[model samples]
Target: MIDTHAHLDFSQYDTDREQVIEECRRNGVQFIINIGVDFQTSKASVDLAEKYDFIYASVGYHPHDAKAMTDSIFEEIAQLATHPKVVAIGEIGLDYYRDMSPRDIQKAAFIRQLQLAERLKKPVVLHIRQAMEPAFEILRRHPGNYGVLHAFPGNAKEAAEGVRMGYLIAFGGPITYPNSQGPQVAASLSLSKIVTETDCPYLTPQQFRGKRNRPDYVRFVIDKLTELFPRYSRDDIVRITSKNAARLFNLPVDDSPELAYMIGKSLYLNLTSRCTNNCYFCPRNSGFHVAGHNLRLNQEPQEKDILTAVERYSGYNEIVFCGIGEPTLRADLMISLAAELKSKKLPIRLNTNGQGNLIAKADLPSKMRGLIDFVSISLNAQDETTYVKICRPQFGAKVFPEILKFAKDCKEYGIVTIFSVVDVPEIDIDACKKIADKMGIPLRIREYASD
Candidate 1:
């Protein structure tokens, strides 16, 4: 994971600085960006980045050091910022709490630095204290400069302002503090605009609150975040935040197309939204995506389009023809791509409303024999009338019996068959499970939750 903010240049780590970094790597801390507060520390931050492969630098002036700024210092910072290791301009902004520098001087220095960062085409890492509104007023003048709000100490309104400006909200030890507003703001905000940091040698988390904070302890910050963001799993938090960090800093990251995405070991292909049935419990009623992926098709994907999406990966457990739509709508494309996909020596699963036989009209079950290893049919309700009421299939009252027949045909043709049902409050769960059991098919119940 990337620790987007830290101050390893401070004198606090003089004796065991190297040892602290070693400990960081051992604890799986991948990258640490050391921030510069002034010219000297900025130079030191650069030296640190050049010395260690895993470390990077950000060159800028801090508010507390604003009084010492000079024309010459700004020129030197400009030169230091040109270093290839430098990723951002900051730990810079207003600090009314300390007033170490005159507020006027702080304002002037902040604006100049903002202008410098804009000229350099680099994002700024903000450092705001008690001067939130004033600082926000300053930031309003500089639009289209995306950055991170380091160690955010603002309320939800302030947080919204930062997000509106396209800035990412960063939290550290303070977020782990008891009764803090950070977690609430984090919960309210989009996960894609959040990042993690340590601000190391300072702002230690609750578990190590009294001691000097290290890069390795960013884990505690992430842990606290998970407790507050219970809706997202730990891996989801990591993947989303890591992607955000990579995007902001131009770090290397992995991505998949919206049309094809991974969940666990399976790669799911969303071809189209054209389905034979419109179930009330279907997630497609609310959105075209699932698990934060945008599955809405711009156009129905062809065989070549699917090949472009799925052929890049090698280790996926299976290629699933599961979308918010009916994969049977493009059964011909599935058949066209089957031989090449089968050559990959990986099993393929198709998820549908089990109306492929009706959609294809001529020997679909037999044609699909060797191509598909498993078929997951959406047999949502138990009886014919209930199925019609829930599914509202275009195939009419005969559709329920046809789905059962399709399942039996798939099983007979040497393919594994499974039935899936969404547990809408009024649906009979036991009854659906019993029907699946009688048909010798496994039942998997899907839970409906708010996005």
Candidate 2:
């Protein structure tokens, strides 16, 4: 997890800063960006970043402190920004609600800092308050992934515009509170541009509401967000939001492969683990990895959850429901999900062991008329005896003939059916091709190994 906004340089953490930083590390908080509100705080943030490799710094003057901004201080900030640890030029912007600094001074500081951000090629962390209109106007004038609207107060229109200009929207601790618009706004925004932050030493989450907030508690904000956005799992949120942070802040995040990732123009779903056959060449035997993606899901994804994963990586050429397992075990889910994805013109495909007839305890092939555009069945063996010996299906000898019937019925339904084999030692590819020809459908020979 990444804390996109925090102030570890503040006095509140001075008592036990090292311990807090260590705690953040222990709690799986991989990175933290300490934000500076003025020259002194900015210097302190740089100092913290220099001390810890995982901590980055963002330097700028807050609108509340705009009264203190001057030519020399601005130049000092410009110099401080050159520090290698600095990643952005904020928490800067208008704060008319507090009126701690006059509107004109705050505007001047905000505009100057934005110009500095553009000059430095760094994203800006904005702090707009009850001044979305003016902030939007200024942002419209100076744009391009401008930065996150830190602790964004509910403004759907402004949030949409910020996303359009390639800005991210960060949700902090306030979203965890009951009866808050922050969460509603978060639900409304594109999850692609959303990130989570702690805003440490302020706006602690509901469980720790009246206390000092820490970077680690950013997980609580994420947890609340997970509750608000039920479709997204914790891992999905972490991966997607982490990607957004890395893109905007240029974070050097890890490039670990996905358990279900895009290959070419397709998105493959792999949340299912239950399968009927235990083929000798089962890919799961190889560290549960498939095409570099770890297909071992912690839990089976619900139908809606599958759609959620699709939506996260949507707009692919097609969505394929195939993994290390027999996808037909969740035949109902695949059918319903395919029906839903079809409306979006996503063209759904399902690669299975052709055991749907047995699992549903009824004829299942023709049931997939409008639900799926394509179906591929694993036909590792041509005859029942060889199939029982190699595929080792739990259904025993009868399973192979049932698979053949399933493929034939699928072809009759005009579902663009195909049969494929893994090219193991004892399998007869020619025999499988002959069966495919006789069945009036095509046969595909899948690669035996990804490497």
In order, candidate lDDTs are 0.85, 0.83
Candidate 2, 1-451: lDDT as tens digits: 8999999989898789899999899999988999999999999999999999999999999999999989999999999998888999999999989999999999999999999999999999989999988988888888643788899985677677777776789998888888888877887775666888999989899998899999999888878877776755666677667767876788887554343576546788775777888887786665565433557777788877676666677546778888778788877877777777778876778898998999899777777887888998988898999999988899999998899999888888878898998877778889988998998888888656421
Measured on C-alpha atoms, candidate 2 has an lDDT of 0.83
What is the per-residue lDDT of model 1 for residues 1-451, given as tens digits with 9 covering 90 to 100? 6799999989999999999998898887878889999999999999999999888899989999999989999999999999998989998999999899999999999999989888988889999999999999999988957699999999888887898887999988888888888888887776767899999889999898889999889888878877887766565566667667766876655444366777656788878878888887676785664654657776888778888888665557788988788988788887777766888888899998999988888667788899998899888888889988988999899888888999999999999999998877667889999989998999999765322
* lDDT leader: 1
- Kindly report which residue pairs in candidate 1 clash with one another: none
- Whose TM-score is greatest here? 1
Off by over 4 Å in 2: 256-451
Error at 210, model 2, angstroms: 0.3
